[model samples]
Target: MVPVNPDVTRFLHDGRLLAMPRRWEHRRVVARWLAHATLPDLLEPLGERELTDRLSELAADPVGARRAMVDLGAVHRTRDGAEYWRTELTEYDELVPDDAVEDATTSEGLHRTLHLDGRRIESVATFYDELDRVFMAGEDRRLRPGLDALDDLLRGGFGAAHGADRVTVVWHAFDRSRDALGFAATREHYLAMLADPRFDAALFRGRLADLEAGRGPTYAELVLEVFADHPGVELLLR
Candidate 1:
């Protein structure tokens, strides 16, 4: 469930923010929320386009939101506007005025856990399905069953994390997932990707060949590779 605090959510409707708050106090709330929500890797600097694209997922006026965050000291950017990073929000906590604003999602110390039962994954399809179900908390919206969707889902700001401070994903029965998504499943996965015009046919063909020779990474390993990009998310394989 999303961490709900009236002080922070008064500016939101559904999941997307309704509007960038106009009042200084109200704006601080929204800015602080964006600082926590938008960036998946706080330590890495993002190009303007990347940062704006991430922000666009949460607000209609991403450009304005970006500017507001910079102005409010919630984010920092290069003078040339080429790169950006989230700023520490500890100083702003005292300015919030409302004690109730300390919600789980915004609390830096709070850590949440999400469990992925690998015992339930029987195939590549079941892997994505179980992932989507667990991450979305059984809500509407099935993931595309592809690496792109997996990246987005793990990045937070929606689904399970929903802007939470930190998330620890435990993949139980991981050995089962490894076997279920092993050689055959990896070959099948690459073959399907090879069929798509958007993918590099040559590269996928090479991967398929490697799989046939019993030398390539399994589908589960690929999932681990993607998880490596998100340092904020701790992935525990059991």
Candidate 2:
């Protein structure tokens, strides 16, 4: 049978089970496709068991797929697990589907998943500013929150800026973020993120050494250099 979504064709290159994509952009596309194909929006708020049963029919990794849907803002669930509903995010528009849920966050349609919000941009100095307070407070608890904001800046503004100004800002933010991540307050989160299949510890350390050696790497260059063209490094912000 033809795949319900053609964007999924790349992963379906094997022409059997839909293999998962390693690239963040492709993974997000596939995630949205799964979210639509499963029709979670059409159902009433489902129990965890019911959702899992439904998802299992759609993918080899039903559980991971569920979490991806949430992260993509395609669905919503109460914290207590008693309820979940299709999200209002209608902004995702890479490959359009007729039955696609019309949630507010939806972007273009069907195939697109990594909706880069122009409004999420921030100056690199903002990262430094947040970390300075955490450093001065002598508290680790404030570390993750500070880093998360920095991650947002990088994600939203990653490719938007260029030239010397962009480089300088990124370098400064990278240094500050490194210090914050290395701190005890946020070390565990940083390490756990390394375990993500996407994060590259070797590339990260090599880039750090290069930066310390006065090599050139604005945030964009550094991430692409170390994270293989994806900001898998930012996943550490969690």
Candidate 3:
């Protein structure tokens, strides 16, 4: 059963409705604005006619305009030649704030574990935590037909590792799934960590399946295996 928290739902609904898409677009524009142009070597101010024309052209046929802009040297293009409004010129440093990076990382981590049910029932505990994030305890499992049986089997609790935080056994039946599951954690960091060569979802599933089948390693062994396979497990297991 997928349980919805009324408070969270209401808050999200209000936030979405109140948010201005245009404001977000403006923010992007401001964040990416360039103080100087590459071509002509003039102190090119942002929003000048030439730049606006270029921006408009780019907006209209973004793919072609981007290529043209790259050729003009007005903007630095990525390896893929996607033009970005030049911010800082440092080669090694990120232009965006560290908090934004952290947030993106947390969001990626949350998304990876979400929507895990349609595939094989590899890690019941892992799958359960993802679901619990969106739904409250005693909530109906929304994705699968055999949820009640699964919930009963799991006894309404699961293991979740908050990012760099202590491990906690969360009751799936609780109302505060967000706090308990670390839903606010940065997904980008989580996903970046998963990029490790040894990280294997297949292996994790295999171990989980073994545990479920009564022929697998103990939970401790499986956890250890996960840690061994993924150095990033420290992020999740901490």
Candidate 4:
């Protein structure tokens, strides 16, 4: 079931209507609540244009709502701005202040995770916090610095140091971002890609560039480089 505060929903018409509330406090609550309401529809990757169009369909001010999603860490986009994913916050039920989340997301403690490989990710909790800032609720050119950090980390391998369970957590978050931003991948294809012996961050970025340049490979083409084989890949585009 979708989670939304009943009282807060009323301010925004049960999440069906949009109102830019006059009060800062009201705006904050409603925007967060709307982010919650946006979950079900965001089950797949969407480009920047696509996401905004969807948001515009419902809200009077689509830009504000879209920005709210990023600002609140409710959604994450790839560093290239080519894809986005909804984050599954472990503590989604908790009542965290918006200010607190903002403060936490921007705090610097991850400078050390860079330039290491064949080692367990030293700071798991810290990694995800920063990861969300860049992926789930990030915006502006502000994303580049974090993206560079991510590339350096991924150059070794995503969740590589962590193994399947840990990879699964961050990967699931990343996978969801793909749903919103990257091309579509079925559960089978996605899991296969995750379980594959190797994942190339460089290759991943190349595909992103292709996506942005209008000459990108289809998801089927992506599966080839990312995995040994994905059956019915041919049927994916038809």
- Which candidate number would show the highest TM-score if scored against the true structure? 1
* Clash-forming residue pairs, model 1: none
- Write model 2 residue lDDT over 120-152, tens digit each, in one string: 224334334433332223333432333344444
The 0-to-1 C-alpha lDDT of every candidate, in the order given, reads 0.73, 0.44, 0.32, 0.43
Report the Cα lDDT for residue 117, model 2.
20
TM-score of every candidate = 0.52, 0.34, 0.16, 0.34
> For model 2, where is the 10-residue window of minimal lDDT?
161-170
State in Å the error of residue 214, model 2: 41
lDDT of 4 by residue, 87-147 (tens): 4333233322222121111111111111111122123323335444423333333222223
Error of 1 at 25 (Å): 54
Scored by lDDT, the top model is 1
Which portions of model 1 miss their true places by more than 4 Å?
1-107, 195-199
Model 4: which ten-residue window has the lowest total lDDT?
109-118
Better of 3 and 4 by TM-score: 4
Model 3 scores what on Cα lDDT?
A: 0.32
Which one wins by TM-score: 1 or 2?
A: 1
lDDT score of residue 33 within candidate 1: 77
